[model samples]
Target: MRISKRNLILGIIAIILIIIISILLIKQFSKDEKPDIKVDEKKQDTLIYNTNVEGIANINNIYIYGMHLNLSGEVNTTSDISSIELVLFNKSDKKRYNLEYEYIDNKVKFYLSNKINEGIYLDEILKGEYQVLLKITSSDEVIRYYSLNNNTAYSYMDYYTITRNGKNNYIEISTLSTQMVIRVTEKTLPKDVYDITIDPGHGGDDPGAVKNDIYESYINLEVALKLKKELENLGLKVKITRTGDYNPGNIAGISPYGKGGRVAIGYETKSKLFLSVHSNNLPLYPQNNGVEIYTSTNNNKQLASLIASNIVKETKINYSSKKQDKVMNGVYVRNFTTSEINTFKREAKENNYKFYETINTKTQYYYVIRETGGIITGAYVDGRNKDYSANLYYNSNIGLDGYLIEMGYITNSNDLKILLNKKNQYAIAIKNAVKEYLNITN
Candidate 1:
């Protein structure tokens, strides 16, 4: 307390210096505790794929029938695919087109532009082969290219008509040229003393109607065999076109050789009549149940009626009024212009007998009836709502007298049950009808 003035001033200066130094240290410590404000300068990694070179097209299921090309496949990669198109290159012109495609079930399908209306007619297109490619483009601006290979070919050349039988028309394209054709060897017509030729419709590849596990072909064969045995027992000569699950010439329906072989057998045996046995199933109308008898021409109406009467009596099933025996006029082509008719006539000569008859005015009947000489009582139910009709007359009398018997509708639960359970009864009914027709009193 009694210190000199110089001593007090020195103490005051020392305390101020201590306070400033302490303030500076405090500020420096605060600066160190504050977090650094550094902007993030990192980027994300993206995956990119290359598709510049040719690769095995990722094609799964692709089939080319005539001019029609069916394509189906899945994209295995994770890239966003914007479009997948089929590219067709005409060998002659080297022309290309990106045909429209539809995506369904993780697959794409398209027809080459000219072959676009439902399906393209190969004959209408060029005569030579064309290069096919599948091109896929992704949202990331990458295009994947694939080359298509043809695996299936047509059996005949010079343009085989799709309507081998009297069914609908379809075009067939062969990978091989016409020069490499394999003709269906001609068959010799037979001459035996057979009174009747029984045909069990649809064998081998053609499985007519199918429901659950039941096949129409199976039922037709069963009934046909039973009838054959009955006819033999009645002391009448009988011949059945097919004895097993296979068709003649391994062809289904009335292919040139298949139908020709069967007919040749009949002609060789001198068979007086032909009859086809078939079963029915309606995909749209499962409730339809009945027995039907059909005659291709008026000449066979009585025969059809006799058989139908017996079938109803035996199976105790309702007879379809729509299936009543009648002469159906079979028009080869409907709504044809004069020029089209002339063209059709000219084309008919190049076709086989079946194809010719299909194009020309022929007896309008079920294929079996129209071509093989008989009526086809197709099973009653159909996807379309309409009355069933058959073809009646033909320009040429090549078809033999015939009738078609649709024993019962396989689509109906009750009918199918009866067809499966009471097959023998139905056979007996047909036998009785044949006996009546022959005037044989056993």
Candidate 2:
């Protein structure tokens, strides 16, 4: 159509401006906008891992223990998903890492570690502050970014140790404003800073055993404190699980494998020896007396023997009269019975967890001995047990040499008296045994 020259020029300019505005609007809408979680400082506990994708993405549980970080979530969408991955971004260095993951039936589980081509990923380059994003791609090639939240049924402070050239890089995962964040810090442990970790078993609400008026937690702590002093007197550095009357390991939950508890203390300290001092209770057989020294099957029994012998001699408490799993007069290597193994298998099946082939009748029944040994000692709990969280350091090649000591039967009159009165004697025996075994001249 014929028109005036100025009018036509103005008309083209208007059209161009209109087109540019439309393009800018489209780009703005296409950009990935992060969902606001509105994490209240006080109400952080109510926050859960829910991506603001309507009903498309919601993470149920995230198991971060030892050298692995596992996640299980649901993709509540009718459309088929092409793939799901965990995206890691380092802002300080402008680096990015795409983590491979496994997803099926709206469930996701994978390892986030420092090794390559194995369940444990050992990439030291994964350092600095990481902003974690869950990348879910649909079959239609549409991509969505989700902020991984801290609603994994409990609070957690995950420490994934990455070792290289005899040093450790602790990959700590924590939640910031309801989103998951990873911070990698290099730590150099001293040669003999921590020689032993003495655990006063069942602190706070968890009293190991109970009698007329005695609490096992109190006895354990008393003995542990004394033992700590004894070991220190011999020029050995010691770390006790808990000093106060509360459960140090039960931060957000009971005995969380990596974050809290005796296992966490043992793993974190990287101590040479881990001694869990606990009292036994046989309510039905109140006549049972004396000490029971527990050592795993694969462990060296020299320490156990020394502790048993020295404790008996020093405290004048003979070996346990019970014949179950007895290796010597006072020493025992307690393992899962056949019936217990069957029960474990059944429980795993019911709970939808992988039944560990590593666990058998010979596997240590005590979590302190078994879970502290890592993969070498068949530490198979990977956050499968609903009651206890995953043992984070369960698969580490470098772990602690753990031993559990039953001071005496708390239910027995004779044993209870010694356990309450002769805590120092028991501590001295354990200390002497450790000195002889380790050849600590100091």
Under the 3 Å rule for N, CA and C atoms, how many clashes does model 1 have?
17
Per-residue accuracy of model 1 over 369-395 as CA lDDT, tens digit each: 544432111111111211221122222
Best by TM-score: 2
The worst-scoring run of ten residues by lDDT in candidate 2 lies at 113-122
- Per-residue lDDT tens digits for candidate 2, residues 1-442, read 8899999999999999999999998877766332223335224332333334232344565543223344545544445567666655443213334445555665554334323112223234355656566666788998776665555544445343422334556666666644666666676545533557898888777776889778999999999999999887776667888898888767667664657667877877756578999999999999888899997775547788999999999999879998988888888988899999899789888888887777778788888888886654668764376447577777665556678999899999999889989999998999999888765555
How much is 437 displaced in model 1, in angstroms?
1.0
TM-score of 2: 0.57
Please state the error at residue 418 of candidate 1 in Å. Answer: 1.3
Decoy 1 TM-score against native: 0.45
How high is the CA lDDT of each candidate model?
0.53, 0.69
